[model samples]
Target: MKLITEKAELFFDLMWSLQFFINTELKILTKIKNRKEYAALPQKDKQVVREKIYEQPELIDKYIASNPDRLNDNHLSIIKQWKNFIKGDFYIERYLKNHAIFVGDNNVYGVLGLHDAFDHLFPSNYLPIYVKTILLPFQGRIVYDGLMQVYQVSFGGGIKRSLSETYMQAKQNNKIITTLEKTRVKIESKAFVEVEQENIWTNEIEQLKSLSKKLKGGDGQPAINSPVFSLVKASIALADKALFDPSDIDALTKELQKVERAVRKVENTLDRML
Candidate 1:
């Protein structure tokens, strides 16, 4: 969805002021006499100035030092954060309720739209649209810098599915970047999740083993002493083994089928005994 209206206005005000400052400081564009003219310039012309600012990120510091607008510390802090900007080609993979998904070379960003929602800009069938843009931190969210260069390259079904998978992987791993400042926290959080997931599986397997041990046949004999309970114990053992290497899909499938068959045979055997 679009950014909050007031925030969007503040963004343009600060951004336009800074770009115009850069233009004059570097004389990148001579014709742009004022912020009004600079704002009205074509996206391509604005892109030229935008690239220059990024190329020399030190300009952001210079602008902060100048503080020509006499902006408050909070507002200047927002502008100073532009130094952490991420620039590259990204695929606009999908649009969700809160934010649209922008998948880059290695990071997925939850980017908010400016004046219009991303879905309104590009139809679902048109995605994953490839575009070159700059992702900046605004307030506490990620947003593009009001200019995008879209490529006309069309993707086939395979590439489309691959891009979709990339988005899903980032989501499942909790790796979708929401803020530029918390990037380090996100990486450490991902590692914690991975360890916790493995521990969950390990605990489940141990519980299963304990349950099997309590299912003794009789007179303190192991459950395997009885033909009927042997299948039940085997099923638990197979499940424990399967959990150890959950990533081996084919192997896990085979183990699961074996466990199902063994349990079914035990059910039938008990029916005959009764």
Candidate 2:
């Protein structure tokens, strides 16, 4: 399965714009706070400036209202959604918690807003399995926070191929794929193999144990001690075979099952000794 489908590209675009807006807003706030005049002001004046720049809601509302032409309808809608959520105490707490998941040391509204935008655009259930498998393993890493970074690293930098070109190449030639895409493909292909091996190994081990218990002699020794020991050895061998030679798994699993059934039949006929 492909990692970045057409639907996924739409979500990526939405997230990229949301993150850009958030980053720009943060930079503007930082510039205001760090201005020489703001710093040189008296404590009373500085407090007033801080409250107006940082604490006041009217400033953001006015900015959004004035910037309608600069932002598309979708962007405006997202900004309004953010404004509404920030007003609620519970939403503020959850937003902070969500921000903590992807970023460290930079817990600003931008990062929180970026996360919220992603959650809005693509709910967890709606994300592609391959994309989830790729990103979930590296959630703590900075590069895992957004698709733009992943796209850059996966495709290379400095005059490298565009996303469209790379995506086309991925379709034609799997050899030049990104590490993340390669890993996703590998995981997708091996999932069934791993599951089948695990099921066979677990079932055989349980069956062997059950057969051993049923064949117990009155002297507290297993009645078919030699056969039980051989089956135990065979179980281990089958597990090793499944791990090393998966192509032969079905046949090996069937043989083990046949042996288990034979042992069960013999054990059921044997009477308890005095």
Candidate 3:
């Protein structure tokens, strides 16, 4: 969804005011004398200054050091946090009730829109929208710097499914980053624990899948056409489904029992062959 009205206004005030100060300090837009004048300029003109500001991110540090506007310590802290900003081309993958999914190079971010929700900005069919923008930490959440550059390239079904999978994986693993202040160690550690727990329960099914790969035979051998591999493959599929939705404990238990029986039959077959 969108940021709160007052918070969104504060974000604009701080962000634009800082950009205006950057323009004045660097003399990029010499004609713009004050904040009011800078605000009056078309978005295209402001975009030019925004690009230049990010080009030399050191301007952010300089602004923090100078504190030209005599902004409060809280405001300066918010500006200082800009050093941790993430600037990149991201896929605006999907929109959820809480935040929009921004899939970056190696991470997924749950980003809040400033004045409007991402769904309002880009139609559902247009997604996953490819865009270049900077993600900033604002009031303990992640928000993109007000400017965004969207690419017009269309995606085929394959690419769309891939993006959807990426979003689902991020959500399943709790890997969607919601704040810039979060440490990777913390996020990864939690994800690791959850994955490990899930893997423990499905370890036997996974081993069966691996063993089926080894049992695969080339050419027209009997092993190539064995029904055992089919059984293992189906078990693996059921295991995967159970992994994603393990709500019905009794159903999962019955599925695991069937898989265990299959595992025993495979083990007996291998014993006799050996």
Tens digit of lDDT per residue, candidate 3, span 155-258? 88898898889888888866778888756447667877777676575777667667767765447875424547656665876777676666677877877777
User: If the candidates were sorted by their TM-score against the true structure, best first, what order would they fall in?
Assistant: 1, 3, 2
Q: What local lDDT score does residue 115 receive in model 2, on the 0 to 100 scale? A: 31
TM-score of each: 0.71, 0.25, 0.69
- Compute the lDDT for candidate 3: 0.81
- Best by the lDDT measure: 1
- Compose the digit string of candidate 2's lDDT tens values, residues 5-112: 543343444333433333245453344432343434444433333333234445446556766237676555433333222110111111123332221122212122
Query: What's the CA error at residue 43 for candidate 2, in Å?
Result: 42
lDDT of each: 0.83, 0.38, 0.81
Give me the runs in candidate 1 sitting further than 4 Å from their true place.
183-274
Candidate 1 achieves a global lDDT of: 0.83
Model 2 lDDT at residue 141? 16
TM-score of 1: 0.71
The C-alpha RMSD of each candidate to the native structure, in angstroms, is 6.2, 19.2, 10.1
